[model samples]
Target: MNKQLSWLRLAATLVTGALAATGALAEDGPQAEAGSAPPEASAASAARHCVAELAPVNAGARTSAIKQGGCYSSFAAAMAAATDNTVALASESSPESVGESDLAAAATRVIGIDYDGRFYSGSSFIWYARNNFGCFGGRSYTANMPGSFNNRLTSTRGFNGCTRNTSYSGFFQTGFWVRCFPNCLYIGDFMNNQTSSKRWAR
Candidate 1:
């Protein structure tokens, strides 16, 4: 029995090592590189698969880029629920949409991420891939904070985070597991001021 357990442990370790090698775990570091290189085909496949798995999403959008309403719906089901205040913010900086730019004004346009309020309401993040790519978004408040965060994403859309609704915490340590996108994202804490980020491929 001891020997059998040892072998099982070894197998588990090997699997974990392989996952770590493939950028599966999140607690440690950034997944990819600094280059704005395109994603792999396998990534496209994975993205599609994730889309079907996370359906009604229509395979394009990001965290809290929309608003919510209607009867009985998953957050992903409502597409236009968010407004790209971040995009408006970037009218001066990245005004024109570039060629084949899966790279939207904000990563949210590319990857639909949203925060289902837990600790607080109205807190999120955004990354403006222009001006050599910069990520910015932060604040903590009651449900009222959305207005402030909205102005922030709109103001810095040229450059960071946009507000869709009430939230107070980054996507990072929010205790919810979400599939991130091409770029990495850091969701700060509501009160503890903790910042956590996830790096997703494609």
Candidate 2:
């Protein structure tokens, strides 16, 4: 009888120890899984920081029309800085590529302006999408538009005494040809929040 009682006690103690070990593992399982989660999950929870690269727009006679605007490495960074309406310049343009977006809606803080350019950096804002992408080419051959070209264009002289257009067609249309300005066809204004504009013979 004594031997049997001792055997039963030993068995109970062993079972209890095994159960405690299992409980400990169960408790640690969730913590270990959580620690192994992907880094992107943490990044998604963090706030987005806006930084842009900028350069000066030099004007010897007339003050530059691009108020708070300048050369940005990328369009996305430019819009982020201008939308904030802060006076400080950006350190670098966002590495992300610019995409097609509704300026009026996305650029709540930025004033509405028109722009047109051959290259991506030509306008204060550049849509990432091609004209063939939006509205099935209803807005033909358009990529970028100037800020204030909705009005009549004026002829202005640059530093080298070369003539440039003060205004241009509102936006470039693709699929079909539409003339926005007759005398000064290609050049346009880089208005508020823009930095510098390149000379285009278009």
Candidate 3:
């Protein structure tokens, strides 16, 4: 009888261990698949790195943009200084190679302007996202900033002016501006910022 009891205990221990192992494997499956990032992430990483590299290319221009007021901060000036500045975009602003998002519900501390929108760091934001397998196609955020951002304005750009049209995918119920000029798209700053950000992201 004692021998029979010992054999039964051994059998139970083996069964318990097997069940635990199976459970662990099941949980790990989806997470492992999700871990398989898309190739875009690699590209985004490279882009961010390049942005950082370009900052030191010219020193005099940097000083000029700075010694004068921050009003005319060039692309380099914006990148070099970490201080928050209010930027204004022209009529009908649509960001490049990005998707539109609405975050008008979030509470934001006033960086400078009471422009009521939460903008993202457009270029770096999208580049990093695409490289990570998340993309919104050849569309920029389509929102309306009727002089104030009531939603997330991609938060990177202080403010840019854009007309909300469905064609550009700007058909949004809420109207808020995304800061493009001095914030994100300073005439091809996308590549530079993306390149530099690559190092930061990784």
Candidate 4:
């Protein structure tokens, strides 16, 4: 009877060990499978950012215009997508006509362009505004950088009515502030890659 009892104990020990091994393998299997996916997913998500165009709805209305365009992979692509192709051609026979057309074009133009590298290299974000009324006669506009673009700007330029750029180190215009008059060929060390928000104005 003692020998039989001893044999039963040995059998139970082996069975318990086998079950524990199985449990460990089960836990490790899913973890191993899932580990490789997040990095790739994170990279793809990071690469996706957006570009936007803004405009007032109507003349003297202060808020009524058709805004269009969407996200793109590069600054050049975004610029192409946002540009107005239906611009009226100025009559070259009259210098006054060309001057008027140039003024009109400048009045409704890109508000700001931010670059990820100094000297305007690397990825870029273009903010185009229509009906801005030139640099001297437009309302101020402020915007927060997108999640992927926050703290990524290294250079910037403002145009049309938005000729002044103020970069903030925190979202919603908090933390440190740096002013870029008309443009910054390279954001200084303090603000380089540290901009999270921006304000544009005449």
Residues 39-157, candidate 4, lDDT per residue (tens digit)?
65665334422466655324444322324356665433455454554334322221111222333544346667787867765566766666545345666666678776888998887
lDDT of candidates 1 onward, in order: 0.28, 0.32, 0.26, 0.64
Cα TM-score per model: 0.18, 0.30, 0.24, 0.57
Which candidate should be chosen as best, given lDDT against the real structure?
A: 4
Query: Which 10 consecutive positions of candidate 4 have the poorest summed lDDT?
Result: 91-100
Return the TM-score for candidate 2, rounded to 2 decimals. Answer: 0.30
Model 4, position 55: C-alpha lDDT score:
54
Mark the regions of model 1 whose C-alpha exceeds 4 Å error after superposition.
1-86, 89-121, 131-195
Provide the clash count, candidate 4.
5
Q: Please, what are the lDDT tens digits per residue for candidate 2 over residues 1-202?
A: 9999999999999999999999899878876576565876554333232222222223341222232234454444555554453222344543222222323334222222223332212333321211112222121111223333223222221111112222323232222222222122233344322323322112
- Candidate 3: worst-modelled 10 consecutive residues by lDDT: 193-202
lDDT of 2: 0.32
lDDT of 1 by residue, 142-197 (tens): 11123323222111111122232222235422433322221113233333332232
Model 1, poorest ten-residue lDDT window?
48-57
TM-score of candidate 1 versus the correct structure, residues matched by position:
0.18
